[model samples]
Structure formats: structure tokens, C-alpha cells
Target chain A: DAMVIQNPRYQVTQFGKPVTLSCSQTLNHNVMYWYQQKSSQAPKLLFHYYDKDFNNEADTPDNFQSRRPNTSFCFLDIRSPGLGDAAMYLCATSSQTFGDTQYFGPGTRLTVL
Target chain B: GESVGLHLPTLSVQEGDNSIINCAYSNSASDYFIWYKQESGKGPQFIIDIRSNMDKRQGQRVTVLLNKTVKHLSLQIAATQPGDSAVYFCAETDSNYQLIWGAGTKLIIKP
Candidate 1:
């Protein structure tokens, strides 16, 4: 079974346009994370939600926003995407237990033109 | 400020041979470590993990070694296969539960 799911495996958006990527999980985890990964680079932490308490990374741009309406759903919203925003967006979920392992979705690849 | 990094960016290994990937982390406060495998166009999948109290853990065909003294971590694959060819990353987290990731090591399978 797919524990974590992201819609629209691939997305293309015009520059300065708004885009939203959705993530859903069946694991019923308490934590959800969003990461941005460029080619040949590590995944950068964008933000995460610990049961509706949104936590944004220090380097995360203001253009990026997230909403977790419930434990099973989380959304990543880019107010205005730029060409630099083109990358693989990954969604992960984890429980709060000690030594908790994070489960990741297939990921959504975003392309900006 | 603290981060995790791989010793090598890429490694090529022969099929059926043992493969080892190494990582270094700067934070001594990190108590938990995990190894993730990311195939092309796919999200990272959890391979194995170890806590600070233990130095070693093993899974199917995979083993993770942690050296807290040098703050080094390594992943060993018993029999490298084509399916094992992917980017491997090591991540660490402290009490805060924020995971810091390494750049990753691309394991190439040589025929």
C-alpha cells in the first residue's frame, strides 16, 4: 500500500504564477515534511507540520507556504514560482516516537518556465 | 550551521561485490541517524537506521555503522546489485527532531 501519496507526479507552471502541490498520507503520522531537491543535490528542508503547527526553515523563502488541515492531508503552496523553484518536491511523514523513521512519497517534480 | 556530508560524491562498484558508502556529520548532539536510498525520479526510501547508543545495525543485505567518536557513518551492502544502484543519503537528528541531510553518494553498478 502507498503510505504517502502526492498528486500530479509532474507539474509545469509559468513564471510568476501560483502553484499548489498536495500530499496525503495513510500512515496517520504526526509529522509531515516538505523538501526541495535539485539535480545532483541533497533534499533541502522547506518546511513541515507537526500536527497543524507549521514550522518553516530559516532559509525557506516567504513565497512558500503550507497548510495541514488534518493529519492525513498537507499542501505546499508557492505564491509566485520562479525559474529557480524548478526541482523535485518531496513529501515525507513520520510518527513522534523515538527513533521514528520517515516515510516518503514518490514526489512531485515541478518545472517552471 | 551543522550538516551531514558524504566523503565521495560518486562510487562505482562491480555487481555482486560489497559496496560501502561513508558519511560525516558535524553535530555531536545528534542521537539518531538514518540511511535513505533514492532512485532516479523517486523520493528517498528509508533503508536502515541506528541510534547513538549502538554502533551497528543490520537489515536485509544492508548494514549501518556509526562511529560517534569520529562522527562518521557508513552503509555496507553485502552483494551489490543493479537494483541497488541509487543515490544514498545519511541524515541525522537531535532532540529537536529536525533532520539534517547529507549531499548523497551515487552508487553506480559496473557490469
Candidate 2:
């Protein structure tokens, strides 16, 4: 099945420590997105890449950054993980521009200690 | 009792019955709408979608209704089952092409 894949389904990091989550897609979608989701809340878009063009949400914190080294792989790097950053990180891909149906991964659950 | 804000609004339904989930979107200019289902410890999965131009769209056992006048959207599920228990969310595509998401509703299935 052509699907999105995320590494380290559960991650634990110390406060102020750096952590990286990875996502790769087999769907060959041009757009890849990263979202932060806290318990019982909606998935909030942190940033996305459209074939190397990075688009960051205005409200996204500076600590969070993303890099799409290639078409199939994208990484989310948190410069300093905070306690509040403990949440599920989801990766999704859309075939084209916005309004396209997104394919999502199982998500990486981060725990900041 | 836990504070109301601590949890998502929940709807409990009996298995084999029909289920309806509702959402009120904020953008009047939103031209596209999608419904997603998120199971526990998993990312959201696309269920169905309806465009502003159309009022209704249906999929396998699922239907989405969009009311542009009221800015309301709904998802209807038939023959609810244990597998249908999950958090359902509605999202709209704004003018910027960004998806503005709604607070999700949790569905519970009773035997």
C-alpha cells in the first residue's frame, strides 16, 4: 500500500533537548505536512513543504523546524523540546495544492520529560 | 466530575444504529470541506469530503453534508460498529488554501 510512514511511534526526550521525527511517503505526493496534536484537540499545522518550498504557519514556534531533503523524506526537528510539546506529531501528504485529500501516517507520540 | 474543557464532546450510539456527527466551520469563504476519523493513538484518516458547490456526497457507508448557508457540516454513518468508534473532525479549506480544523467529537459504540 502506498502510505505515509513515521519513525519511532513513541519518543521520549529530556526538556530542552533536541528531538527529530521523520516521515516518508510512498504516495509520491508533492506536498508534505507536519501537524501537532494535543489530547482531544484538532491537528494544528506546524509547517509543510511543497517540493522544497517550506511554508510555516505564522503561529508556529521558532523551536520547530522542518526539512525535506528529498521527495520521499521529511524531518521535523525541535531545537528544544518542552513539556508542552508532549503530543502526537502527524505527517500527511496531499497530491497537489490545498483542498486535496490528505494521506496520513500513524503519527509519532512525543513525550518530553 | 472532570472539567468540561478537559474532554471533547462525545456521542454514544448503539451498534447497528445510524450515527450523525456535526461541525460548525468558521470560514464563510471556505470552498472545500473534509471529514476525518482519528482512532486512539493514530493519525486521522480521511473518511469523506464535500465541496461547497455540492450539498451532499456519499461513500461506502458514509455520507457528508455541507450547508453553505449556515456554515455547518455533518457526517452520517450507517450501521455503526465498534470499528466506527473514533474522533471525528471537520476541516475547511480557506482562501489561503489552508485547512482550518474544527474541534473533534468522540463517538462511542454501545453493544
Candidate 3:
């Protein structure tokens, strides 16, 4: 099936350490997104990539960064993971149109120690 | 910062009953609305969506209603099952392609 896939379903990192999560899509969507979700809260958009153009949310912290090396792959890099950064990181992909629905990966659960 | 929010935090329904989850959006320019379902330890799955031009859209066992006048969006699930227990969220995207998301509503199915 054409779907979004994330690596390391669960990750544990030490405080102030760097961590990277990866996402790949067989769906071949043009736009890919990264979202951070804390317990019982909304999945907040961190950043997204439209081809090679990266769009970061205004409120996203400087520690968070993303890279889309190609059409099928994207990566989220946290320069310094904090305890507050412990959350589920979701990767989603969608068509280029405004109203297109997004398909999601299973998500990576990050635990900062 | 703009936001999409839910009217309720939790909803409980019995099996075979129907469930309705409501959301409110801030941006009037948002033309696309989607409903998502998230089970424990998983990503948000797309349920249904409605365009601003339409008041309602239906899917397999779900219906999405959008009331532009009030900026209210709703997801209705028929024949609720234990498998349907999860968090439901609503998201809206403006013409700019930025999708504003709502705090989700947790749905509990009672057997």
C-alpha cells in the first residue's frame, strides 16, 4: 500500500542531545509536514516542505529543524532535545492543492530523559 | 497565532449509538476542513473533509458538517463501536496552505 512511514516508533534521548526522526512516503505527495503532539493536546505544526522549500511555523522553536532531501523522504532534527520536547512526532503528506487531505505516518514517540 | 478549537474535551457514547464532535475555527479564509481520528500511540488518520462551498460531506460511516456562518465544524459517526474510541480532531486550511488545528475531543465508546 502507498503510505507514510516513520522510523524508530519510540525514541529515547538524553537532555540536550540531538535526535533525528525520519519519514518516507510511498504515496508520492508533493507536500510533507511535521507535527508535534503532546498528551491530550492538538498536533502542532512544526514545519513542512513543499518540494525543497521549507516552511516553518512562526512559533516553532529554534531547536527544531526539518529536511526534505527528496520527494519521498523527510527528516526532523532536534538540535537539543529537552524534557518538554517529549511528545509524538507525526509525519504527514498531501497533494499540492489547498484542500487536499493529508495522509499520516504512525508517528515517533520521543522521550527526553 | 490563529487556532482551531473544540467545544468539548470529551464525549461518551454507547455502542450502536451516534457520536458528534464539534470544532470552531478562527480564520474565515480557511476553505478546506478535515476531521481526523487518532487512536492510542498512532498518528491522526483522515476521516472526512468538507470544502467551504459545501455545507456537508459524507464518507463511509462518517459525515462532516461545516457551518460557515458560525465557523463551526462537526464530525458525526454512525453506529459507534469500540474500535471508534479515539481522539477526534478538526483541521482547517486557508488559501495559504497553512492548516490550523483544533484541540482534539476524546471519544469513549461504552459497551
Candidate 4:
């Protein structure tokens, strides 16, 4: 099946340490997005890439960065893991023409200790 | 400001019965709406979608109804089963690009 795949379903990191989560899609969509979801909240958009053009949200912190090396892959880099940053990080893909239906990956659960 | 909210935080439904989840969006200009089902430990799965020009749309076993006047949207799931237990979210976007998501409603299926 052509779907989104996330690496390291669960990750544990020390406070202030840096961690990275990755997402790849086989669907060959033109856009990719990264979201942060807390326990009982909606998914918050962090950043997105339209082909090679990156769009970062206004509220996104400097500690967070994203890299889309190619059409199939996107990476989320957390410069310093904070306790508040512990949450499920999700990656989604959508076509430029029909970007409403976003297909998401299983997600990576980050735990900061 | 764009905001999307759900009427109820949780919904309980009996097995074999139908379930209705409701949402209210503040952005009237939003053109497209989508419904997603998220199981525990997994990302959201796309369920159905409806455009602003349409009043309703249906999928395999799901229906999405949009009321533009009230800026409300609803999702109806038929033949609710155990596997239907999950968090349901409603999202909308004007350009069908960047989506503004609503606080999800947790659906619980009871036997």
C-alpha cells in the first residue's frame, strides 16, 4: 500500500537533549506537513513543505525545525527536548490540488525524561 | 481568527447502532471539510469529506453533512462496531491546503 511511514513509534529522550523524528510517504504527494498533538487536543501544525518550499507556522518555536530532503521524506528536528514537547508527532501528506484529504502516518510518541 | 470546536467532548454509542458526531467551525469562508478517525497510538485516518458547495457526502459506511448557514458539520457512522471506538476530528480549509482542525470528540462503542 502507498502510505505514510514514521520511524521509531516511541521515543524517550533526556531533557534538553536533541531528538529527531522522521516521516516518509510512498504516495508521492506534492505537500508534506508535521503536526504536534497533545493528549486531548487537536493536531497543531508546526511546519509544512510544498515541494521544496518550507512554510513554518508563526507560533512554532525556534527549537523546532523541519527538512524535506526529497519528495518522499520529511524530518522533524527538535533542537532541545523539553518536557512540554513530549507528545505524539504526526506526519501527513496531501496533493496540491486536493490538499484537504491528508493521509497521516502512525505517529511518533515522544517522551522526555 | 479561525477556530473549530466540537459540541461534545465524548460520545457513547451502543454496538450496531449509529453514531453522530458534531462540530462547529468559526470560519465561514472555509471551502472544504474532512472527517478523521484516530485510534489510540495511531495517526488519524481519513473517513470522509464534503465541500462547501455540497450539503452532504457519503462514503462506504460514513456520511458527512455540512450546514453552511450555521457553520456546522456532522459525521454519521452506521453499524457502529467495537473497532469504531476512536477519536473523531473535523477539519476545514479554504484553499484545501492548510487545514484548521477541531478539538476531537472521543467515540466510545458499548456492547
The candidate that achieves the highest DockQ relative to the unseen native structure: 2
Q: Write the per-residue lDDT of candidate 1 for residues B1-111, one digit (tens) a residue.
A: 112333548899999999999999999999999999999999999999999999999999999999999999999999899999999999998777778888899999999
Candidate 3, residues A1-113, lDDT tens digits: the string is 74999999999999999999999999888999999987888888898888889888899999999988999999999999888889899999988853688899999999888
The best candidate by TM-score is 2
DockQ of each: 0.38, 0.52, 0.41, 0.41
**lDDT score, candidate 1, position B32:** 94
Task: Give all candidates' CA lDDT scores.
Answer: 0.91, 0.92, 0.89, 0.90
Q: Which window of ten consecutive residues has the lowest lDDT sum in model 2 chain B?
A: B1-10
Candidate 3 lDDT (Cα, whole model)? 0.89
After the best TM-score superposition of candidate 3, give how far the Cα of residue B48 lies from its true spot, in angstroms. 0.4
Which candidate has the highest lDDT of all?
Answer: 2
Question: Compared to the true structure, candidate 3 yields what TM-score?
Answer: 0.93
Greater DockQ among 2 and 4 belongs to 2
Q: Which runs in model 1 stand beyond 4 Å of their true positions? A: A97-99, B1-8
Residue-level lDDT of model 4, residues A1-113, one tens digit each, is 73999998999999999999999999999999999988877899998998999999999999999999999999999999888898999999998843458899999999998
Task: Point out the worst 10-residue segment of candidate 4 chain A by lDDT.
Answer: A93-102
As a whole number from 0 to 100, the lDDT of residue B85 in candidate 1 is 94
* Cα distance off (Å), candidate 1, residue A48: 0.9
Which pairs of residues collide in candidate 2?
A: none
* Candidate 4, B1-111: lDDT as tens digits: 012333549899999999999999998888999999999889999999988999999998899999999999999999999999999999998654568888899999999
Residue-level lDDT of model 2, residues B26-69, one tens digit each, is 88999999999999999999999888899999999999988889
Per-residue C-alpha lDDT of model 3 across residues B1-111, encoded as one tens digit per residue: 112333548899999999999999989889989999999999999898888999999999899899999999999999999999999989999878777788889999999
User: Residue A11 in candidate 1 has what lDDT?
Assistant: 94
The weakest ten consecutive residues by lDDT in model 3 chain B span B1-10
